[model samples]
Target: MTTLLQIDSSITGPNSVSRTLTTAIVEKLREANPGLRVIHHDLAAAAPAHVTPANFPSAHPISAAAGDAPEFAAGRAASDAILDEFLGADIVVIGAPMYNFSIPSQLKAWIDRILVPGKTFSYGAEGLKGLAAGKRVIIAVTRGNFYGPGQPTASFEHVETYLRSVFAFVGIPNPEVIIAEGVQLGPDARQTALDKALQQTAGLNAA
Candidate 1:
């Protein structure tokens, strides 16, 4: 059976369009494949601690963080678990909502945990090598304002760009991105954008 890791990072709870679309996308995937093991991780509800200077020590490099230091060991373990989870998943679905022209700090912290040297990637003599390259990722994005090519806020939209760059660095460069824009405009605009995103979700290549 294929394993899917679904991460929801929206702090808006039930009103979050990204979460709504993400759930639908996972359901669609589940329908396409039988007995798919899905893991749901909510970053908003349980955000991981931010990476700090204390954990930057050579002995506390996440994977080897559990030697003897009790205080730093927990952070190291969390980081290791985060990286391991991503490495083990066949597919990843992320509900990423745009907050203040960027992603949530919680989600960013999660990203820090996974982008470990020699774990998810390595700097070889060839410049850089991506060790974890085969996993498929689907990102569900919700934007309060328009951020497409022609939109005024296009340049300010960091949600997609940051995710794309980060994932590419770790190996998966071309991920399938679905967006729900203009969500906070009004009722009609929100519904229209949401419905459009959901349509895209339904037609997604979950195979």
Candidate 2:
């Protein structure tokens, strides 16, 4: 059976536009593939601690930080689990909202969990070689203002580009992105952008 992992990183709970769009896409995916196994992870509700000295250990035993002795091991274990989940999945759907012209800390944490050395990728004689293959990813992004690459507000697009670039590092090329921008501009613009993004989701699901 096809396994799909759905992740939501928006702090706005269900009210987030990116979350709403991702939900719609997931619903469509479920309807289209009833045999699919779906796993939902909400990062906003369960924040992951950033990597630190203890979390980033060498091949040998290392000293632990106060109150972080257990956390260091737990963090590595969690990252391994996430990496396994990604390796087992056929598709992944992520909801992301722009924060300071980049991805949210929660999603970044998830990325750190999945992008591992000698697993998802490895060093090659030339540079790097991604081990992961035959997987697909869809990202739904929401922003307060309009932003598209080469547009006036393009700076806001850094998050989407960053995700695509990083995912590609693990051989997940051509990640689909649905953007809902100009939400905070006004009511009309918000509805319009959301509708457009929803339509894109519909097309993605139909495909």
Candidate 3:
């Protein structure tokens, strides 16, 4: 059976555009592929703690000292759990809203926990070889202003770009980005953008 990991990191709960769109995508996917197992991760309310100086050393497991510090041990354990989740997933869908031109802190924390060296990815003869192979990723991004076309808003789209690049570096490439841009640009624009995104999302085939 296909397994999907749905992650929503919006603070606005059910009202968030990204969350709604991601949910829509998941629903459509379920309809297309029956008997699919879905796991939801609401990161906004249940955010993983940021890796601090105390736990930072554990990020590099090989470089850490003989014994793990209390905080470092906690961080390692947390990361291990997340990595297990990632390894088990066949597909990952993320609902990410742009905050200060970047993804929310919760999403970043999740990424930090999952992207472990010698685990998710590793240095290869050519460069990096990601361990999580053949997994598909879908990202639903919501923006307050018009962030496409020739505008300064486009430059501020670090959230989507960063997610794509980082995940691609770890071997998940060509992720489908269904964006609801100009959401806060009044009702008309919001509806238009959302309608367009929905159309695009509906056309997406499972990878």
Candidate 4:
């Protein structure tokens, strides 16, 4: 059975294009494979605390007596749980919307948790080696305006680029990114972008 971990971080609720597209992607994927199991997480409602120095993990395990506060300990546990979920998933689908040219705070918090040193990546003689390889990542992104190559606001966009770099650092160098751009242009443009994204989702193959 294939397991799909779908994460939605959009705070815009039903009006979020990324969220809708992510659901569509999952449904289309299920069409290709009937036994696909999905684990859905809404980060906006259940986001973990941000990574702070107090809650940071050490290369070696730290005991509770090592000066960690109760809140910090709980935060650490939450981070560990997020990392475990990512490690267990075979496929990851993310609904990421651009907020002020970057990703949402909730998604960033999740990234901080899963990007653990020894689990997701490690430094070796080869410089850097990623442990989480062979997992497929699909990102559904919604941007307010156009930011493709040679566009005026291309330099201002960081959501997709940041995610690509993060996933590549963890061994998924090339992820399938479906984008709905110019969503703030107008109703027609928003619908067009969404339609195009749906087409991409429908064309996805079973992993």
Q: Report, for all candidates in order, the number of backbone clashes.
A: 0, 0, 0, 0
In candidate 4, stretches whose alpha carbon ends up further than 4 angstroms from where it belongs are 57-71
What is the Cα-based lDDT of residue 7 in candidate 1?
Answer: 94
C-alpha local distance difference test of each model: 0.87, 0.81, 0.83, 0.87
**How large is the C-alpha RMSD of every model relative to the true structure?**
2.3, 3.2, 2.2, 2.2
- For 1-207, candidate 3 gives per-residue lDDT tens digits of 899999999999866889889989999899889889999989998888886544443445642644565645766676667777887999899998988889999999888777778767899788988777788899999998977769866777788889998788777878888998888888998889889888988899954
lDDT of 4 by residue, 1-207 (tens): 788999999999999999999999899888888999899999999987776765555332442335666656666766677788898999999999999999999999889877777888998988888889999999999998999889998999999999999999999999999999999999999999999999998888765
Regions more than 4 Å wrong, model 2 = 56-71, 205-207
Cα lDDT tens digits for candidate 1, 1-207: 799999999998998899999999999999889799999999999998888744532333543544556676666666768878898999999999999999999999888878878778888889888778999999998999899998877899999999999999989999999999999999999999999999999999979
lDDT for position 94 in model 3: 94
Clashing pairs in 4: none
What TM-score fits each model?
Answer: 0.93, 0.89, 0.90, 0.93
Q: Between 1 and 2, whose lDDT is larger? A: 1
Model 1 residue 205 lDDT score: 92
Off by over 4 Å in 3: 53-63, 70-72
